[model samples]
Target: MADFGEILESIGDFGLFQKLLLFALCFPNLILPFQLSSLVFNHADTNHHCNADWILQVGPNLTKEEQLNLTLPRLPDGSFDPCKMYVPMDWDLSAIREYGLNETTTCTDGWVHNDTIYDATIVTDFDLVCENTNIFRAAQTIFFAGVLVGAVLFGPFSESFGRKRATQIPMVLMLIFTVVTGLSPNFYVYLASQFIVGVALGGFRINSIILATEWIGVAQRSYAACLSQVLAALGQVMFLAVVYFVRDWRIDQFIMAGPLGFIVVYIWFIPESARWLLYRGKTTDAKELIQKAAAINKRTVPDSLLDKALEEKPVEKGGIKMLFASRVLRKYFLTITFAWCAVNLAYYSLSLNVGKFGLNIFLNQLIFGLSEIPVHFFCMWSLEAAGRKLSLMGALIVGGVLCLLTLAVPQSNYVAIATLATCGRFLMNGAGSICYVYFQELFPTAIRQTATGLGSTASRAASMLSPVVNMLEIYHFTIPTVVIGSLALASGIMAFLLPETRRTELPDSTEEAEGKRGPKLSNPATRDCEDIQATKL
Candidate 1:
């Protein structure tokens, strides 16, 4: 039987139809970074001190500086304590000044935030500072938890339904929840809406790649994967621009949600995945879509070729269990999934806590976003040149080493810390970009979405922990860096065990995916012709 790849070649491996589909699927990728990284902006740190307005009754004539000096305690650093204030007394302002306040307590009133950088953030609006800081981190954790849930649920949902449906539904849900998130009356409402948005984000992120890659040829899979990220990186840059100008989390949320409305409308035009259709035993629908694609690409698929594709039997539906049945698959599954977790743990830890670098948050985020475009582009080449395993391993180990190197730098030297972090982010992103192609190629089509979803679930689980790990910096500055770097190093070592799938056809069945069979070759004639052409050149 002609496998789906053979049919893709006959009709158009990367012809107009495939290009159109790839373009459409990748467009939505631009908006995802807004949700993923928005926390950095939405909960940005603001200069604040405890509100001590009650003292104003007695100190009505006191200047602003005088009020703070008299009402708030100073830390050993000589800065006014942000979380504490002097207990109020019945004495007059003159007597209070002479005696001085003896005891301190937590902020009795609200926080007074200096919103010069951000006019408003979830932090300032909800007063998620000092004792309430963990609540902001918890909001991030909740969002990633939603992503984890979405991965488990949407993976199978896409497998059962068509990929187009999976993609479309999430776009709508993302839009709705994002709007709700902007209008949230309280912190609890914001958390709930963000969680739903996270769920939708998880579904769209997974299925978009699967739907695009299922139509693309094996040769272009790296390009298909990395290009989506390139656009996402650009989106990060653009979102930074939006955040820079808007400066309010609510308006930012509404602006981010605006693009999705158009995406939801246009996505309906894209067809369902032919590979998915065939996998579901809807061969007729698969054949029809293929024919339409072939026509659109200005090519004609042979009747025999189409008939052979139809003759291939549908895969059994056993969900994730199918991945564990084979010993070889189990090893691949474990190795790749752990690698996914480690990379995300490192990536998001730095990504979420950009403020810790002590640089201008906008400039810091801009540099971070700008860096990914080149790194991902380089990754596209490295995947083809150095091969998947070597590329992933090199990026991870090197990135981890850079991450560890930060321990020697003083936190007060924000410039030095930001420099090392930028370098670390550059390499970590490369490792992450490689995983997208690596994961898709490792599993058979029968369980590809399931495996991808589960891998993403592991990554999201890491992302959930990433915020908590960042919180550990409160105990000791070195803790977050140590944990992140250690995991990257460990996972880099784990990458040594993964089989190289460079220049190989994607496996289509359990038999093909097992043992050494996972790295199945392309058509002998085509490969030979390419080799011969290379020799002649």
Candidate 2:
């Protein structure tokens, strides 16, 4: 029987229709960075100090600057400390300058904040500064915790309910919650919204990638995986530009939500995955989508293609049980789970920590997004050349080493640290992109989304821990680097333990998946050659 790949070949795999699908799917990918790191700009730090300075007693009329100068200790950066103030006592206005008021204490009065750059952020609005900072960081932790739950939910949802519901529900909810987050009047409301948005985005993020991927043939899988991320990078660039114009976090949220929310309208156009439909015993629905694919791509559907796809009866229902059923699969499952966790931990840690390198945050974010573009492009090509295992392993090891090298660079040199950090980002981006394609390849069609969702859960767990790792800088600066670097190094070594999947067909059954050794020759699918050649035009 000709499997789905041959059937896809008969119906013009990756032709005009697929390109159109890619453009439509790119919306979620584009808006992802806005939700993912909206706080980076939305909670931007502002200059602040204790209110009712001791100098106010010196004279009824003193400039805000003079009050701050006389009352606050200077930070290492030449800025006045926001958390501490001089003791208020009787003093002569004329002799105040001569008085040695070296005594100081933590701010007893409310703070006076200065916002020269950002008009408002959660930090300014709610005063998420000083001791309240951890609660603010907890917003992200709460968000990732929501994502962790989402990853567990979406994969199984997509498998049981079909991809369209799994995807579109999250798409709409993510948009709604993002706007609500902006409008939230207090920290708790804002954190609740952040958590829901994270939940919605987690489902949309993993399931959408799998939905489109399952439709394409083996030959296009490598580039298809990164295409999703390239669209995300494009969104991040646009997000940086948007932040420059919209300084208020609340207004920024509305801007990101309004236009991209239109994606919800396009949901009607998104076809159900025919493969997933067939796996769930909906052969009639599968054939209908197949026919639509043929008409849109301007090709004839092979007769009885759905019948061929159904020849190897799939397990009636797909779930996490399949992931642990076989020793080989269980090992692959554990190894890739760790790899995904390490990749996300390293990626989020560096991204959130970019402000510490003393570069402009917007510029650093723009450059970081730009720097990782080449890695995706490289993955687009290298997935075929280096193959999945070598490429994934190389990215983890090299990215890990580059990050560790940061410890050797002097703190005074922001440029060197930023450069090495960007390079590490590049490698991790490669690993992450490769793993998206590679993990899906490791499973059969019936259980693929389930396994992917489970993997997403583990990665979210890592992301939840990442902020705490980033926070370790206060205790010891090197601790974060050591933790992230060691995970990456260990994950890279684990990559060697998995079988290589180069030009191999997506497994049709769990038994078939377990039967094969990992490495396969990097050969073009000759079955797909004529169709792919036609696609070149």
Candidate 3:
């Protein structure tokens, strides 16, 4: 029986066709997140705040003149005078206005505001300050909270079903909620819809990362993973374009919702992971998928090789318990969880605060997105040569240092701060992609998805707190940057403790990974001291 790696070797390595397939599948995942961000950021409530609307509630007994006197400016200078603003003392008018109210002219003399009429309407109900700070924060918190739930569920579903199926289901759900979100009649409904949208986003995000890595050869896995995120960055850039054109949040949500229809096209072209199929005891299906992949690469598959690839070895059914049962596995799990949390904390905190950095919001997002192109290439190069741990450590350290530097600068030094922050973003982005690929590589195949899902959930959980942390105003910009920097530094130190995995074959089982027996197919050379210790039990 030929080795599975050798069989893959028989096919072309990272050829044009393989790259094209990955590129097509990666494109949608990348674009979808940014489009979703539009829904998050451009809602009517969000825009009203951005536009500085100070909505105030006033009694209906107040004439239009009186209402205007209370809300609108009285001075010729067109500035509001808070001292002169007054509202009617009538409780009935206040109650009606609070529920829904309309006005009509009185026949007796001057116009009289009527409180009896009821009309349901969507109106900005908060002052500009409340809208900008509290409302926006609420939206961000809810969105990520949904993401946390979806990410937790993403792995189990993907493992139970298949990668392609798991990946597409979220897109369908995202399409449904995104369209409905735009049509939401009230703030509560809109918020609820965004939460659902976040869940769909969580599923799509995890599957996209997993599937992208699964489809490629080991030699190309690192590069493929980095490229997938590069596309994500591109999605961020594309969002700027979308936001520029469709300024309204509801319209933007609809626009984002519309492209999801294209994801249905993936059902025809995207193939399930051959590796996942092989692991799931669907060897024949795996072989068939591999053959189609070979065909796409213009290669032939031998029947003998295909049959050999189908033969099963003893493997255990993995569950969440297996992740923490062993010392080595426990260590990897903890390291991955911390690293994921740190990455997300810094990544999201930075991304969510880009508008505060003095660059135009659209241009800031564009710059941040464009910076990722080089970061992805740099990550691919570093991971392929220097290995995973070092790449991650470098990224974390660089990002942390830059984040700390932000504290020393003033708003007047906007360009300098932007440059530093942008560099930090690049490093964090690259580090995150590196971590995703590295964490998956470290786990045994049986529990890979579970571990990945757990790590993703941890990251999302940490992300849920980002908005709250970012909302802190006491220390100005220093507080958030300091917190993000400290977390990154901690993650970098923890990363150093993880084992190096460059050129090392992925472990097939926990026993093999622990070196319980002789060297396995994946690692056939002299055993290290740690391997011997792991095998001793």
Which structure among the candidates has the greatest TM-score?
1
Clashing pairs in model 1, backbone N/Cα/C closer than 3 A = none
How high a TM-score does candidate 1 get?
0.95
Please, what are the lDDT tens digits per residue for candidate 1 over residues 1-537? 577888888887888998888888888889999997788889777889999988889878889999999999999999999899999889898898899997999998899997677889999989999988788889999999999988888998998887888888889999999999999999999999999999998888888888988898878888777888899889999999998889889999999888899999999989998988887788899999999999999999999989988886856667678888878888998998888888889989999978778888888989899999999889988888899999999998999999999888886888988989989988988888788888889898889999999999999999899999988978988999999998899999999998888867778887777744534345659768878999999
The better candidate by lDDT, 2 or 3, is: 2
Q: Pick the lDDT winner.
A: 1
Per-residue lDDT of model 2, residues 1-537, tens digit only: 446666787787787777777667656787888887686777677787777654666577998777777778888999788788887768787666777568888778777778788888888888877888677678878989988988888877887798888889988888888888888988889989999888988888888778778777777877567987887788788888888887888888999887666888896579888877767777778888888888998998757765686564535343567678778888988898899999999999998887787788887898898887777888888998888999989999999999999999998899899999999988887788888998889888777887888888999999998888999989999999989998999999999988877777788688666755333333347536856888997
Give the alpha-carbon lDDT of every model.
0.88, 0.81, 0.71
Candidates in order, TM-scores: namely 0.95, 0.91, 0.81
lDDT of 3 by residue, 338-446 (tens): 9889888888888887777887666777888899888888888898789888988888987899988988888688888888988988888888898788876788778
TM-score of 2: 0.91
Model 1 score (lDDT): 0.88
* Rank by lDDT (best first): 1, 2, 3
How displaced is residue 163 in candidate 1, in Å?
1.4
Candidate 2, number of clashes = 0
